[model samples]
Target chain A: MKKNFKLVIEYDGTNYAGWQRQNNAITVQKILEEVLEKLTGRNINVIGCSRTDSGVHARGFICNFVTETTIPPSKIKYAINNLLPNDIVILDSSEVPINFHSRYNCIKKTYTYTILNREEPAAINRNYVYHFKRPLDIDLMKKGSEFLIGTHEFDSFRKIGSSVKTTTRTIYSIDIEKQEYYIKFNITGNGFLYNMVRIIVGTLLDVGVGKMTPESVKEILLAKDRSKAGMSLPAQGLCLEKIYY
Target chain B: MKKNFKLVIEYDGTNYAGWQRQNNAITVQKILEEVLEKLTGRNINVIGCSRTDSGVHARGFICNFVTETTIPPSKIKYAINNLLPNDIVILDSSEVPINFHSRYNCIKKTYTYTILNREEPAAINRNYVYHFKRPLDIDLMKKGSEFLIGTHEFDSFRKIGSSVKTTTRTIYSIDIEKQEYYIKFNITGNGFLYNMVRIIVGTLLDVGVGKMTPESVKEILLAKDRSKAGMSLPAQGLCLEKIYY
Candidate 1:
């Protein structure tokens, strides 16, 4: 009998070359497929909900695959997790409908970016956050984020050379919070273009640091030019937080 | 003119061979001294407050060194931080009296040991915490820790074959708190023997898992034999948190 297994994964992407499989680099997808092949004695094809960039982490990533192994679905997580490295963990596994596709069936996705807004750089969490030395105005950043709350053509907030069927996307929310010296941005959207979230965060950071006005973000979005947007932030600060099916 | 400078440092000890300088191993002291030598163009010796084991982290580690350089104390941190690796950071630097020393002037110290008590081990914080699969009884651990408070001879908790001037130490308090799946043991004491904190945490874990009763900790202390105590936990879970002068 053929069974479709959905897996909830958590990974520290510091050492991986992103979610996609590549011939010259180690990736999360390749590692997962190898582990599954070892466990089931067959070649495996795993589909990830998002193609997280190199050095971007994930706490609640979703993926799926089909297998004909006799191992129970409930036991698959434990078996594969033991064989995987310490940086990637299979949090949960369940049998799903055969037609289920992790990427095509995803309804919403959430991502978070963290900045260590302090004078000194962090040592313990150096690989997990972006260290920004200047003081930021949270109010201005929040005001600027409001312009990104609804549907908009996000060409200005995407990678310059990236292409997609449509540049329009719906942003459900953008919540910014600060605790002590750490600032976190939580964003939920139906879809995001290449480097979209990082570019958005960079634009908001510019607003916070008085480099750009809060209302200027509206103009930047309307311009639809990647050069008019803020600099794209580093990938280490971004994390795939959740995906709603 | 010779001036003494005190530094507050933070380090992720995942890649070093402990705090002391050794001929065959890379250590924190060696790195800091090398950085200082590069900055000041002279041989420098740094004295640390504690001799942490390999893979042990620190957030507020104190150290002191005397130098004749003309750089301001406030600028030293920024200058050295730029040259040090990302895993080590100098958080603060200030001029201290010539007679002041980081080790001799320290009056109290705080260390924290973190355990991830859950079915699945952590992926993101794999290097910073000990992943224990068994569910721990926080209440039982707290009860057992009470026997270790106040002044006592901690010979049983020290590492076997490790010699110290005195086995007597004063533990001010041991606070155990569980947030989500992480159980943190914060211990404040006047001094700690070699591997004392790790051994004490291991003994408490034994009490938490019903392997030993809370009352048995008293017997272990009274026995003053290393074999009477529980196992010494791994070094990664222990961190030097603070030093009070």
Candidate 2:
């Protein structure tokens, strides 16, 4: 029987090349494919909601896969997780409709970026967080978020190879909080371009450091020039918080 | 200058064979000794407060080394950390008298054991926590802490190769707290025999699981026989919190 399965995955993406499959490097897709093929003796295609960059980590990222195998959806999670590396695990799995694509039918996606701001360097979470020695202005960063809201041409925020045809997307909300040594940036959006969230974070950081004005983000958006934006933030700080479908 | 220097170190301990220097396997002491030999031109002897077992991690385990290199105490921490692996870090360093020993001068040591109590296994913290299938009674675990406190000869909770002449130790405190998916055991003592703290935690888990009464721990301590105590818990759940001198 043809079936669609939705899976909630958690991964420490430091060891992997990225979420996508590649020839010379380790990837989450290749790991999942190997487990599925080994279990069912058939080639299985796993589609992930986001192609998170190398060094990025995820606590709850959604993905869907289709197969003609008669194995129960409940059994699939256990069977696959048993073979996965210690860095990746399936948190939840269940049957879904045939057309339920984790990427296409999504209503909103939330992403979080954690920064360790302190004098001493971060040791334990070095692979999962970006350590910035300088302090960031939260109020100024909040002002920058307002410019990113609503549908507009986000060419400054999108990477060069982002396959999406249009750069217009709605950011539902942006919440920033600093707890202890961690500064968390949680943003919700209807859709995001490749490296969009990370790029936004980088530009906002520039604003926080007094390098760029909060209003300059609007100019960058209107100018549709990538050169006007801040450099791409390190991928280790980013995480796919949740995907709504 | 046969100078004595103290080190407060943190290590993941998964890839390490143990804290002691061995022939083929990688160990924390081996790494530290190599770094010291290169930084200071002497074949230095290093001593750790606890010779932690394989896969047993530490947050602030203490160690001391003697060298004739004449490097300042302030520079030792930064210099050694530069050569250490990502899993290992020197939190701080200080100059101490030649008579000071990390083990002999220690007043108290604390350890924490984390249990991820849930049906699903963990991915993010696979190396840092033990996964359990059932929910634990937090109150029962807290009540069980009382039975393990105070001065006691814990022979039943010790390992076979313990070199200590006596099994007597004073437990300063036992704290149990339940977080979202983790039950944490925090224990402080003047000194612990080999595998003593892990065995005590395992016994308390049995009480939490309804296999033994909470008060039974007192009897096990008084028994003074190795066969009467609970099994040693896994190394991953344990973390050496601090060693006070």
Candidate 3:
């Protein structure tokens, strides 16, 4: 019997080329599809809810695929985990309705960018955070993030060559918190463009370091030019934290 | 003019063979010595305070070296960091007395072992923690750890192949703290055996999982036999946290 399965995944994307499969690079989608195909003895295409960039980690990424194997949903998770590498883990798996679509049904997505705000580099968490040696003003960063909330045209934050038809997007909230040497930025929205979270975090970091003023972020948004905003930071610091469906 | 210098070092240890220099494998000491030899016009031997096993991390491993260069000690930290790999960092460097020795002058050392006691495998901290899937009873572990406090002839916890004349050591304190999924064991002592911290943690984990009783640890200590205690845990979870001069 063919059944639609929903899987929530966690991966430390340091070694992967991203979620999309490529001919020359290893990707999460390629490995997952190969594992499914080997188990079910049929070619399969695993559909991911979002296309994460290279080196972007995920704690709760959602995906869907149809399989004809008689293995139970709970057992499939265990089987796949045993075959997959240590960096990728299946957090949960369940059978979904035949009409269910992971991408279309995703109501909201949340991303988190972690920055190690310290003079010394982090030894253990080097792959998980972006180390910024300079001091950052948390109050200024928070004030700058307020301009990112609510609906707006996020053209300035998106990558210049992105192929999205519309640059407008709705943001639900933005939260910034500090714990000792770590500064985390959590942003929730209906959708994100290419490198949107990283660019926004980069701009906010500029504000925190006194390179840019808080009110100038509004003008950058109004300008709708990618060059007016801060450059996109490294993908290793960004993570797909959670998704609501 | 020759000058003695002290360096505080930090390393991830995931890809290292150990702190001591080896013939076929890469070690922390070898890298430091090579970097110093290149910087100065002389062959250097960086003497570390401790000889950590393969895969053991360090946040504050102390070492010393003598050089004839006129480079300021403060400038060496930045220069070495720029030349060294990302996994190793020189946290601080300073001039020390010519008679000072890192091993003999070290009065106290603290080591920390981190355990991810959870059902799921650790994704982000896979290289820094030991993943124990079974449920661990903290009270039982703590009770077992009490037997290891204070001065004791720790022959049972020492590695079988080590060549120490006397197996006596003094432990100043042992602190156990749990934060969410992580359980950290910090042990401060005048000196540690070849595998003392790993063996003690392994024994405590055995007690936590009902493989052994808390009272058995006392008997194991009294026996002074290496076979009486649990096996030494992996070196990846152990870290040299700090040192007192």
Candidate 4:
């Protein structure tokens, strides 16, 4: 029985190399595949909703895998989660259509970046959150986020080694919200280039620190060059919020 | 310059032997005291709100120490918290009256025991929570909590090797609150006999599983023998909530 299963997963990502497999490093896909193989004497490759970068967290990124084992979808989560490490959790697992690919058939994806916008270093969550001591203008950050919405040629924000050729991407929304010690940037888009979210965060941080104006974001997007954007922020602050396929 | 200082500290407790000083094992008090000796060159002793058992946690358990050094009270927290490990966070520190004590001067103490009420083993908080497979009836557990109120001689609940001569204590209240995957036993008391909270949790488990009734708690309390009480719960689920001095 070729069973197509969909899975919703959450992970810390600090210990993992990335979603993709590597020869020398531990990866999320490799861990899951090894766990499944241990369960049913056969190797099954799990496909992720997104190839999340190193140190990027996730709340509910989707995945799909085909297996010939007779195990039901309901028990798959329990079986896999039991074997997985403490940092990763499988939220929900179900049988879906055979044609429903986690990556290609996706409708939209949402990501969130968190900054511990305070003076003191993050003691407990230092690995998960980025700590910024500099005072950030919240209103200016909001304005910068406003300029990020809709279709734009985000060539300036794309990473140098991005495999994709197209730089034009449609962002559904960009929400900048802040609490006492935390600032969150929620971004929804159809697709993203390699290290796109991190570069955008770096630019927003530049805008927040008064180095650049909110209106300057438009010019940076239009420039369509990597040098036109700010440096790429670390991946620890970024979280894959969800995947809608 | 003999300064009497108070501290409200929080720790994961997974890495510590307990709050007391031991010869070889790692302890929170030992860590703080060693750091104090290194910085000030005087072998200073650190006192804690309680001798929290190994693997137990704390949120705001008070501790006090005296030093002759001229390190200002406002700066002590900065110096100590900086030296402490990542799992420990000094929330506040201030100069206190020389007459004040962390343990004896407290009005009351509050402790909470959390049971991860789920089928799957806890992944993220495996060290911080206790997992249970059996379902518990919340209303029945609430009924059992009523028996723990007021003054009682809880000899059965105390550990057999406890040095304390008196077994009589006053339990202010017992609150059983359930939310999703957690069932918390929030207990406040004038003072607790050795391992009283752990035994109480074990007895409550009996109540939740239908082996014992809520009214049976009195009979066990009056038994005044260690064998009459339920088994002692694991230390990992217990947390010293606060020392209400």
Candidate 5:
């Protein structure tokens, strides 16, 4: 009998090509599928809830797969973690309804972007943060972020070559916070377009650093032109923080 | 006129040979001296407060040097950090008296050792923390640490080939705390012998696991033999946290 299981994963995506499986490079999905094959002794395809970008970290990612192995649900996470590499951790696993789909059942998603705004760049967290040597105006960034909140068409923040049929997406909220030398931008949305989170963060950073005025964010969103927005931020600073279903 | 200056440095020592200047390999001191030459147009020697081993990180390392550069002490840190690599940062700098010596005038030092106490090894902090897969008894580790606190002859914890003339060192405190899956051991002392902090942490970890009894720690100290102590922990887990003058 085949059993369907839901898996929650965490990974430092620095070495991964991305979450999607490809023949040329290593990916989180490929590794998960391979590990599942080894555990079940059968070829399987694992479907991820999100296709996180290369070099982007994830604290709570979800995936689903069907297996014929006799191993119980509780022991699957423990068993998989033992064989997985240090960068990839199977945080939790459980049996789900056979028809449950990790992607289609998702209600909301949250992403966080970290910026190290200090004179000296970060020494230890360089890979997890973007080192920007400037004092950012958090208040201005917050004011500019307010323009991005609420449901709207986010075509300006979407990548040029994205395959999505629609450019409209609803941003639920954007929270800007400053802790010591780190600036964190937590953004929640119904769905994000290709490179939407990074583009939004980049646009907000431009407003914080005086490159662009806070009022410019509104015009950029209205224009619906990708060139009106700032350059997309690096993937290292972006993390897939959480997913709700 | 030459001026003496003190610098508080932070570095990810994963790639460094050590804090000391050596003819072979890349050391922190060698890179600082080279950067100083570029900044001041004069060859200079930097005297560090402690000689940290290779792969040991530092958040607040102290060092002193004399130079004839006309750059103000307040701006020196900013200038030097620009030339230094991303992994090394000069956190602070100040002008000190001509006779000020970072190594001689230091009154206390603090170091922190981090252990990822979980089934899976860390991917994000792979260079900064040690991964130990076992159900560590924190209470037992804490109890064992009590015997090593206060002033004691730490000959058992000292590494072999150490040229220290005296084996006696006074430990001010040992703070052991477990947060989630991370265990941090912060130790403060008047002075530490070679590999003293690492060896102490290793012994406590052995106690945390069922490998050694907590009460056996006292007997190991009394034995005054290096062979009686546990193996020294990896250097990557150790960090020179702070130096108090």
Candidate 6:
């Protein structure tokens, strides 16, 4: 009998091409599929909840796969974790409904972008954060983020190359937190378009640095022009924090 | 005229041969000296507060050097940092008294050892923490730590090959903090013998795991035998947090 398994994964995506499999580069999916094939003695197809960009990290990434192996669900995490590289870990594994889809069944997703708002860049966490030399105005950034709180057409916040049936999405919340020299933006939404979160963070950062006004965010959303939005932030600063079912 | 400068540095020591300069292996001091030489046309010698083990990290490591360069002390950090690798950063630099020394004038040092006490190891911070599979008893570790506070001979904690003038050191405090799956031991002392902090953490971990009782710490200290103490933990889990002058 075949069983479906859900895996809670955590990875340092610095060395991966992205979450998806690619021909020319290594990816988290390819590595995982190879390990799964080795463990179960069968070809595997793993479905990831988010297609995280290159150099993007994940704290609670969700994925699912069906397998004919007799290995217990609880033991799969330990077994695969031993085979996976140190940069990727299976935090938990469990038996799930056979038809449950990792991407389609997800209700909401949360992402956090960290900025090292200091003069000197950090050495230890260099790969985990973006370094911004200017002093950020947290109040202005918070006020600017208010305009992007509700459901809207986020056409201006997505990469130009991405194509979707609808560019409209619901943003649940955007929380800007400053701890010492680090600024973290916690964003949750029903869905995100390609590079949507990074562009939104960059737009808010422009407001924080007084390059753009808080009121301009609403105009940018209404304009529906990608060029009107701020530049896309680097991928390393962004992390897939959680996915709610 | 030669000017004495003090620099507060931070480094990810994964790729180096420790803080000290060596002939064959790459070291943090060697890198800094090379950068300094490029900026100023003189060979530089940097004195560090601690000879941190290979693969040990630092947050606020203090060091000093004398240079005859015309670059302002405040700008030296920026100048050298631009030439240094991303894994090492100069947090701050300033002119200091001519006779000041980083190792000799240090009053106290604070180090933190982080343990990821969970079933699986972490992927994002794999280089920054030590993963322990078994559940640790925090109260037992705390009880064992109390005996190590105050002045005592730490001969049993040092590595066997280390040649120290005296093994007696004053431990001001040892605070154990647990947040979720991470257990951090913050230790402040006037000085530390070679591998002393790692050995001490190993002893406390043994007590926490019930392999040794809390009372055994006193006996271990009294015995002053290297074999009586627990094994030395890995260097990656240890970090030099701060140095006081």
Q: DockQ winner among the candidates?
A: 6
lDDT per residue for candidate 4 within A1-245, as digits (tens), equals 69899998878788898788889989988998899899888988888888998888887779999887788898889888888998788888899988888998988999998898865555445666787879999899788877778988888888897778688888998888897678998999998888888889889899999999998888888788889888888988989988887
Candidate 3 local lDDT, B1-245, one digit each (tens): 88999999999999999999999999999988888888886899888999999999999999999888889987888888887989998889999999889998999999999999877787767899999889899998888888888899999999999999789998888778899889999999999998999999999999989999999999999999999999899988999999998
lDDT tens digits, residue span B125-146, model 4: 5666788779998888888878
Please identify model 6 stretches exceeding 4 Å from their true place: none
Rank by TM-score (best first): 6, 3, 1, 2, 5, 4
Candidate 3 vs candidate 4: which has greater DockQ? Answer: 3
Model 3 chain B worst lDDT window (10 residues): B117-126
Put down candidate 6 lDDT per residue, B145-220, tens digits, no spaces.
9999999999889999899899999999999999988999999999999999999999999999999999999999
lDDT of 3 by residue, A98-208 (tens): 778889899899999999998888876799999999999999999998998999999999998889889889999989999988999999999998999999999999999
Off by over 4 Å in 5: A22-24, A31-43, A67-85, A93-95, A137-152, A160-179, A206-231, B34-43, B70-83, B135-149, B206-231
Candidate 5: which pairs clash?
Answer: none
lDDT of 2 by residue, B1-245 (tens): 67889998888877888688889989999999998888987687799998899998998889998777767897788899888888898878999999999988989999999898887887777888988876677778778779778998888899877788888899989999887888899999998899988898888888888878878777888888877777898898888989987
Point out the higher-scoring one by DockQ: 2 or 3. Answer: 3
Stretches of candidate 2 exceeding 4 Å from the true structure: A119-123, A135-153, A160-163, A173-181, A204-225
Give the true-structure RMSD of model 6. 1.6
Native interface contacts retained, candidate 4: 0.23
How much is the lDDT of residue A104 in candidate 5? 89
Candidate closer to the true structure by lDDT (higher is better), 2 or 4: 2
lDDT of 3 at B44: 94
For model 1, how does the per-residue alpha-carbon lDDT over B1-245 read when each residue is reduced to its tens digit? 99999999999999999899989999999999999999999999999998889999999999999999999998999999999999999999999999998998899999999998988888877888998888889999999999999999999999988988999999999999999889999999999999999999999999999999999999999999999998899989989999999
Interface RMSD of 6: 0.7
Higher-DockQ candidate of 2 and 6:
6
Error of 3 at B60 (Å): 1.3
The 0-to-1 C-alpha lDDT of every candidate, in the order given, reads 0.94, 0.86, 0.92, 0.85, 0.91, 0.94
Please estimate how well model 6 matches the true structure, expressed as its whole-model Cα lDDT: 0.94
Error of 6 at B166 (Å): 1.4
Superposed model 3: Cα runs more than 4 Å off: none
Candidate 5 per-residue lDDT, tens place, A9-106, comes to 88999899889998899999999888888888889888788899899998889999887878999789988988898889887889999998889899
In model 1, what are the clashing residue pairs, if there are any?
none
Candidate 2 or 1, higher DockQ: 1
